[model samples]
Target: MPVWLIWFIAALGLAGAEALTGDLFLLMLSGGALAAVGSNLIFDNYVIDGVVFLVVSLLLLVLVRPALRKRFNSGPALPDRAKALEGKNALVLDRVARHEGQVRLDGEVWTARPYNDDDVYEPGDHVAVVHIDGATAVVAKVV
Candidate 1:
């Protein structure tokens, strides 16, 4: 019946769509529709309410949505398995050179390569895992 009531209903519909999507985009539009309801109640003009809705929606989409998405998406700070192996000592199982080698890390033998192109490790030599590249472990002299 009233313009404000229409806007309120639209806001509720947008919020319902947002629930199904789980994305904040529709929620931002729903916020704009709610603002339109207030504008309609105050000015009682369709054009003014439309303008308010557009401006509020754009503001929320550009500014508020990013912060909200980041806050909700950034979950627990769990440690990465590969990153955990960095700097840990491993025993060279085979001659380790820049091109290829093998090392025992955490009781498991892994394909290895020297971090420095010229560095080489012999069997029984201890080295530190510099980083992991796919299935290979880049290692450096432990000392």
Candidate 2:
């Protein structure tokens, strides 16, 4: 195959692979390959082809990436609600004896305790999920 055809084929292949991997960097490489093919076809000069490919690759990766990602991620099913739950209210179900017990948060049982504080609590106490310290919740009394 011709150099331009080879470069175009490589560009399509790289673009497909980038789509499969879900990474943005390979898209720049695909842009570079396509730019090389086009520039070589237009000018047929080694230095100008290289320069055009470099400029196009950098422009695609830097200027277009954030917009592409924003468009790609724009949807109603965004996972922002999970982040809102931090510092939310919950209720202790078991004795927070020595800073350890189970709590009921939105009807789900979660292991919780006073976060970063040395304190004791009891059942039926209201607490706030201050933070998550791994599998357990670091909660404190909501007063």
Candidate 3:
């Protein structure tokens, strides 16, 4: 019946929903509800309680959360030693001449092409997968 009770219930419900959804964003809203309820409880002043909670929640979501996510959500795009080979190394599995060949890297075979003429390589030659062009891998002799 009280606004404080409403805020607390809403917070608890959102937290439970976050447990089910596993999105992590809803948890921020739940945090806001908790702050609101806590402020209301401590001050018994609804206006100040609501304002403080709102400001806190917004600050947490906009400033704190993005920084935290950048640190914690490192995945394949993370430029670290573990993914070093992604932009380097390829094995020439086919007799390559000019602009067409096959290479093996990234745990799979791929159609390879060269950047220019007069570039030729043979099977078992180590090449560098310079870049990916569409469905093919562009290669250069490793030297």
Candidate 3 residue runs with Cα over 4 Å from true position: 13-26, 43-45, 73-99, 104-108, 117-128, 132-135
Please tell me which predicted candidate would have the highest lDDT against the true structure: 1
Worst 10 residues of 3 by lDDT: 78-87
Which runs of model 2 end up more than 4 angstroms from their true locations?
A: 43-48, 66-83, 86-88
TM-score rank order: 1, 2, 3
What TM-score goes with each of the models? 0.68, 0.67, 0.57
> What digit string (tens of lDDT, one per residue) describes model 3 on residues 54-87?
8877887887778767776875665643244446
Supply the TM-score for candidate 3.
0.57
In model 2, which residue pairs have backbone atoms overlapping below 3 Å?
A: none
Provide C-alpha RMSD values for all models, in order: 3.5, 3.5, 4.6
Q: How does model 2 fare in lDDT? A: 0.81
**Model 3 steric clash pairs:** none
Sort by lDDT, best first: 1, 2, 3
Query: Where is model 1 poorest over a 10-residue stretch in terms of lDDT?
Result: 72-81
What lDDT tens digits, residue by residue, belong to model 1 across residues 43-124?
Answer: 9999999999999999999999999999988989889889999889999999999888999999999999999999989999
